[model samples]
Target chain A: MSDKEEREISRIKEVESTNLARDDIRELVIETKKAVEKDNDLLANKIHRSFLDNNIKSFDIVGAIGAGKTALLEKIAEKLTAKFRMLVICGDITTRVDADRIEKYNAETIQINTGRECALNAYHIHQIIKNKDLQNYDVIFIENVGNLICPSEFVLGTDKRIIVVSITEGEWVVEKHPMLFKMSDIAVINKIDLKERLGTNVEKMIADAKNINPEIEVITTSAKTGENIDKLLELMGF
Target chain B: MKEELTKIEEIIANPNEIKISNIQELMEALFAKLKNRVDNYIGDYPTFIEPVYLEENVKIGDDVLLGPNVYIGANSEIPNYVEISNTIIFDNVKIGENFKLENCIVAKNSSFNFKNLNMKNSVLIGAANLKTELQNIGF
Candidate 1:
């Protein structure tokens, strides 16, 4: 073989050899949790203080996978972008899907790809806000990794915590993830467009959230059609 | 069979799922959701995996790797040296050369007109007249 061909062959081999058999994602979740102690939790407070000082409104959105977090954010950005200086710090385990989606509707996006952790904690925000000119944007939306349980435990230095659940997730979604509801300032029951055919109990879902956190405001929306989005923004103090 | 396919799709949601999702099927569903009854084929055959929907006015360039469940909407452009799989590209969008995209939904009127970009598992949308940068992974 020619020298160039030999070099290419060795390069391919080198790339293949680096593909290690890592632990499963589930195991990685548990391993990541071991580090989320009091000290780690306090890191978010630091970021929160900075946001407060800068007068930046931070909204942390947490939800189940496919619960329409990105869709909802898109709607919000579409409606409020002309009136607000908005940006989204979108988190995912591997890809920049949420960030990319939100960016479509006139909002700037910062894609945070969490390597193995199931959630975005204050530490992640602490690291992210370090470089941002915090004054450029008045409102920041922190779209947490699409997860119900793990994301609830992490305070992402946001002013308000919003948990989104879709009727597509089934009737028991709110009841099942009570802690997420408890931690949230508002609960969004999304995808009402599919509710009629799916026959999901929307009222029951609202009751579930109300029972868990009486202070939590509940809004039913179809992010697809922009239904009740204005009401959501109004409640969010847009 | 659909239920089995759906179970595979659930794997795509959970990062910790043991099995891989059937991406090709899901891409098909996404395209069918927004498909219009119009011809979109406007290019010579690159490599296309079975069952893709190219919406009206869609254009493909040479040496492209297209896969199943892929949908290119009307008035969109997929240039040469591009590899796409399990993706949904909406209307009025543009693509560039040496691009590799998978498991992504490119929203309407977006521009990915950049060279040598690699994006996977993304939902891309942006304003018109906006240019995209290429992010090359690995050394």
Candidate 2:
């Protein structure tokens, strides 16, 4: 017999030796198919129409862990709470730490524990707004789970999608996760206060992001030191 | 000191006069002493349900069932029809209606209001003020 046929026979034999059943494999396949078949554009359009109907501006913030996403949101919430009615939906694998921190700024907050999900999808946002009175807020911010890879694949239906990356994550972060930058409307290079100490070339990182999508708006800020936060708000048309 | 020594040569040769028969005997004695110390340390180790301690101000509503390895801290409120198993709840927690929790840790000052939700092997930290009508949600 052919070598490939022999290998396939051995693989089938190995599967038969294990306790894994055919029904388990079938269920996994069905679940995976459903997840892969989710339509992003349709959900995005629905979310956009919902926001337009309610006269609310929404933004989705995505980033890797320790990328200063929550810090940036906290800074923005603090600066804008006086003028705008804001609501924050913090998405995490577990814990409501970000939502609790944002609550100090006196904005209404909802914490969505995604459990094992890596990224927050449009369905999550839809569920949050399905029953609530959307007209109660002027702006909504959905802070996606701390991830750079999976969040790019799921569009959570927002007016603007911002990806935050820190200079401390090394120089190659933008280059490594180029898909996130390409899908994002704006890229925020955070933690500029440590730029000199870490010897990170911020200009090069910005150039890499621009290379992915030349039309993307790039803003640099240090959330800790409150640098260029007003400029970021201005870019968002606040 | 001479009586303490098993051999006169040991007392003469060793200045400290702490004589052992050999290195093997000394190791066995050391290990035996350590085992005894550890056993004594763990003699009063409490089981899951034995010697349960509940704070005076803790409020437990009707029809609440707590399984093994469950600890409810001070001022925590377990409302009606809630079941908890293998869970550790800290102070000031307020659990609302008809929720099932297993192998979970609920942090301090958190409040949850949901029905028919099952959470297992989850660690919920910080304050949560949630109100939802959950159905068949398992985590």
Across A51-115, the per-residue lDDT of candidate 2 in tens digits comes to 98999989999999999999999999999999999999887765567887998997877766554
Which residue pairs collide, candidate 1?
A104-B125, B28-B69
TM-score of each: 0.55, 0.58
Distance (Å) between predicted and true CA of B39, model 2?
36
Model 1: per-residue lDDT, tens digit, A1-238?
Answer: 9999999999998776654423336567667776665656688788888888988888999999999999999999998889888978777655455766788898977665454467877765664576468888889998888889988677877889999999999999999999999999989999999988999999999999999999999999999999999999988987
Considering every candidate listed, which one attains the maximal lDDT? Answer: 1
Tell how far residue B30 is off in model 1, in angstroms. Answer: 38
Relative to the unseen true structure, what is the C-alpha lDDT of residue A69 in candidate 1, on a scale of 0 to 100?
93
lDDT comparing candidate 1 with the true structure: 0.73
Candidate 2 stretches greater than 4 Å from native: A1-37, B1-139
Poorly placed runs, candidate 1 (over 4 Å): A1-35, B1-139
